[model samples]
Target chain A: MATLMDRVITSKAAVLEGSRAIAEAVRLCRPQVISAYPITPQTHVVEALAQMVADGALKAEFVNVESEHSAASVVLGASATGARVYTASSSQGIALMSEVLFNIAGLRLPVVLTCANRALSSPLNIWNDQQDSLSVRDAGWVQLYVEDNQEAVDTHLQAYAIAEDRRVLLPTMVCADGFLLTHTYEPVIVPTQEEVDAFLPPYRPQHYLTPDKPLTMGAFADPEYYMESRYLLDRALERSQAVIEDAAQRFNRAFGRHYGGLLDTLHMEGARTAVVAMGSVVATLRDVVSGLRDDGHAVGLVKVRSFRPFPKDALRSALRDVDRVLVLERALSPGGVGILAAEVRAVLQGQPRQPAVSAFVAGLGGRDIPVETLQALIARAQDEAVEQGFADLKAELVEEGDEDES
Target chain B: MKTRVEPAPELLSPGHTACRGCGLLVAARLALQAAGPRVIVANATGCLEITTSKFPQSSWNVPWIHSLFENTAAVASGVEAALKALGRQAEARVIAQAGDGGTADIGLQSLSGMLERGHDVLYICYDNEAYMNTGIQRSSLTPLGARTSTTPPGALSWGEVRTKKDMPAIAAAHGIPYVATASIAYPPDLVKKVKRALGIRGPKYLQVHSSCPLGWGHDSSLSIRVARLAVQTGLYPLYEVINGQLTNVKRLSYRSPVAAYLKPQRRFEHLFKPGGEALLAQVQALANANAAKYGFPPVTEGAEAEDSD
Candidate 1:
């Protein structure tokens, strides 16, 4: 006689790296279909899963697609028929699948994908950065960032919940830092398959291609109806934010893990200086905050989990008490400050006693950002806040010479 | 074998707003018949999209979606893929329909991706020679010596200096399972080709010669007449490429001269003027070369099948 936990067990607790954690989480989800093509950083995630499927650990259809476009197409087909689907890609792979990515969103299929954040190539560097994920910010998928291996596992479980929620039938992206989280192994508390089973119910597609009940998933919207269709999509996305938060709360109640809804704050109590960041950089910020606190400085950290919903009110409330807010952005918007900084500034507009916000663009093109550098960034932002009082808020780029200045 | 075949009345109706004698409307009707009731169409931004689906009202009787200008094939592939994944392959047939500009020029890359992926989809290009919805712009499928908004006759050059794109040849090169060319002039033949394309397992391409009366500067009644002449003159030969091989050629026993095809339309009026005869003769020679290449066999003495009305 097997126990309830054994009946629900999808994966075992093992010392797995972040990338392998992603592979294992997806395996436990038991995706009926996987379509992937190899690209730097993202290759290992699929490769590990391919080996699992080959070894019969995961019983799923693995499609070795020719291009990123075909890979997206394969998953779109598999998912359209009401099957659980999964895919992984990075940088160039994301760009190649850009067209189909938009289509998958428009068709409203709950396709789960992991983006090992990497730099876009022209000169072709396969290192860590958020350029790929940030490039697809408006792609209409529920985007989430994981700071460590545990979050990677936890979020994959919640992604199915958020994406498959009847009210929010949208695709979800689980993004992690390339090489930083993907290659770095750590101790993660894997939820017993039973816990996951209770957390994530079987996906019952609201609309799918079926002969018994015929419904059109994708229909032509001419100009007259096009704007209205887009309006509906916007409304759906706005509704998804609440759905994600509710799903997170439910997940916490079920697993006893306080997976914060949309966004998470650490050590923001009575702090005058705050640093806003996402992905694996939050771990470095946590270390920096502890070091700063030991030296009698009031510094804190805020980890942005759901970048798509933007969590404007929550972010504003978190930074209200702080006199200085330092934003560490992993990608640049070419002619302006980082995209995140622009979005955060937009949210801070017309708010009472808004903190002196400074934008620091770092970790671009897979450049390494050490904990010492992040500490310097926080210190410089606080100093600038006291001296210049938001005058240097839009600091464009922290160049090599400025490293010593900070 | 002159069997009477009646057009299905349910697929498309007469009260639609398509221009009178519009060949694309005829093509759409035949295509819908072949696709039957369980069909979903992904239409591109073109004349058909604008005229049929103008927001407040839609002329489409079946499920239809209008994606972007160049992504009809990609969208249809998505729909078909989803349907197949859901184990409802026979629930509906996905059809991607676009104009010449959308298919041959702008949407070519996405179309190629869909075909290369071998999606269970049928892509139909209603070749009306120019971008009619955008007002007579020259498209890749526009024939040589045809005057268009972009390719107007001038002192230095004639209209449309380049030859019409060999679309069927290019599609066949993709190694798709089925590829064919048809015209609205031959409704039964076009319908049969559509049915054949749908019956194929993988990606299929069908290019239909749809005439534009307003854009071509011809009498509205001359649309079908001009399309028939195009096929008879070997200017737009009807043929099928099965499994990458040019299997069947829709040959005309006695070919007509290119002048008969060009004289009715104002777009090709320049080809019959002063020194244009020489250019017209060159056009005729090109048609003759095509006939020779496709091996159009001569008709026997008394063995001829009568055209069914």
Candidate 2:
């Protein structure tokens, strides 16, 4: 029997950059209000939506806010009114909206934030990195990182469904790399509104601010109840795994694309060694893994799409047979080590058939993580285990007192 | 002025946990009367939210949400934008209320964003001149030479060095449909302005001068008197700007000296001492400047105050 999970819906294939694909997917979701503010690579996503609103293609209020803080607040308010809302930002914009980010999630307002992942600044750099999004990992939001433009488009479509599910009414951060995926042009399959509608239902919220019945939301709880509220939030996020998997499966059935539940795996067949990573870096690692597999190396790739709710069971089962696991991260914890790699170790801990996990940080401030870089890292790890270490680091850059005053 | 009309059906019930003679409570009730039933209030974290909605008991009859201290305007902007998209913007109104510190300082950017976006929200700033919720810390709206927790009078200092933040003027700069300053002492005038703002379409800002008896170091019984004196002395003007034009001004029937307002509050008690006389005069000079700028009608020498009651 061809159930809904087995059926496939065809979409119109078109060439577009990652940002445009996200905009089109959001348009297909039929959001009623979009809080928009521009920052670097994320600006294109918002601009595309603005054009859609201007051209009468999307029926929504495109609020051109002054800052990312206001953008997030605008969407937070809109979502509270039970309007399906969308917003996108990157880098400092995300940091700027940090306060409201936690508020949205804590309030359990299902606001979909398309976070075009970028490097945070001191010496300002506008490039692809996961620091901005990963820094906010503990903000009680469902953070998902996409590997490519196609995955970025599909993940956005599924993000709304997973976020809006009544059982998991938390905000979702659909993160894609800044300039790499956002600016790179690729062939993306654009699903029709009818197809998207069939996959994702109209958002109906259980809690909202409206005139019909008076209710108070986002109220402060005393210490007696604060822990209870936090516990409930934690439980809801943990329970969200089922909804995310079901949504992803439904989306795959509706559209001829598959995003593995929380994490995607490549060439895992009888592999002895595996590599785990997130964001655009996963694609580079996947290419390296495939090339090494062709050379008769027993290696595989595990792409972590959802960084939050850590997909423990799925990840544990996926790597149950592997003997060694390499975890690469695009984000570092400043004084500490890799962000994603640390979480990966936490997830893989306490398993019966645990793999020897090694952490390697790469691509900070968007230093290009090409296939060659991953290939070289693999060769180095073959001889010595890279435990919570930096991969392909510049030797001269870290040497102190290297500068001469003019 | 409409005569003898009973206040609108109460959305805020009695038994709210406000301190004795909290002017913000009265202002909130009057605002509720003006805004009526079809409004969602995005209240910022302050005395109002903490007092009204505690634990399981909420004093508000209307839909209300107390988010963070510095994001009420942004939340209200969201509510209004959502209503616009939901095709119910006209039927349901959005109001963002914050205290002086929230409105004039920490929340100023959000207020600016809400107004600049023109999201059809009515934002009310309950200006108490200081942060009363967090133990009366001096705020931007804290007048010059007033004492607060953070701005104590010392050997070489005269308390808060900054003048009151002209919040209504700052809100007016956004060119919103209505920007007005009201006083809790004048309920009819204050409620009238709120209703008038509610009737307008785009963004409207109302800064209601709400006296804090605890923060101002005054007798609880003198709350109304203090609020009244703020306007009567021209320290806080009662005026409305409709679409950037000065549409209405509440001409003072009797103008009092700033001393009458400052002398009763311990926050300003320093200004009365011999060494602080100069600062007291400076405060009076500020009042005179407000009177001159607003073109307030001067009272006749022997005329009794019409508003004395």
Write candidate 2's Cα lDDT for B46-157 as tens digits. Answer: 9999898877788888989877888788888888878888888766888999999999999999899889877788999999999999999999999999999999999988
Fnat value of model 1: 0.19
What DockQ does candidate 1 score?
0.28
C-alpha TM-score for every candidate: 0.87, 0.95
Which candidate should be chosen as best, given lDDT against the real structure?
2
Q: Which stretches in model 2 have alpha-carbon errors above 4 Å?
A: A1-11, A400-406, B297-309
Model 1 lDDT, residue A97, Cα: 80
Off by over 4 Å in 1: A1-12, A30-37, A48-84, A96-109, A121-123, A187-197, A208-228, A386-405, B7-9, B12-17, B297-309
What fraction of correct interface contacts does each candidate retain?
Answer: 0.19, 0.77
- B305 Cα displacement, candidate 1 (Å): 16
Cα lDDT of model 1 by residue, A1-406, tens digit: 1001211322455777788888888887878778788987888789989999899988776766667776776677567767788999999989878877787788788889999999887768898889898899888888999888878888888888888887878889999989988888887777766777777877787665543554444555667677887777677778888987888788778875654678888778888988888898887877788789879898887888889878887888888888888888887677676677878778888888778878787777777787777777887898774221122222355333233234
Cα RMSD to the true fold for all candidates: 5.3, 3.5
Model 1 RMSD in Å is 5.3
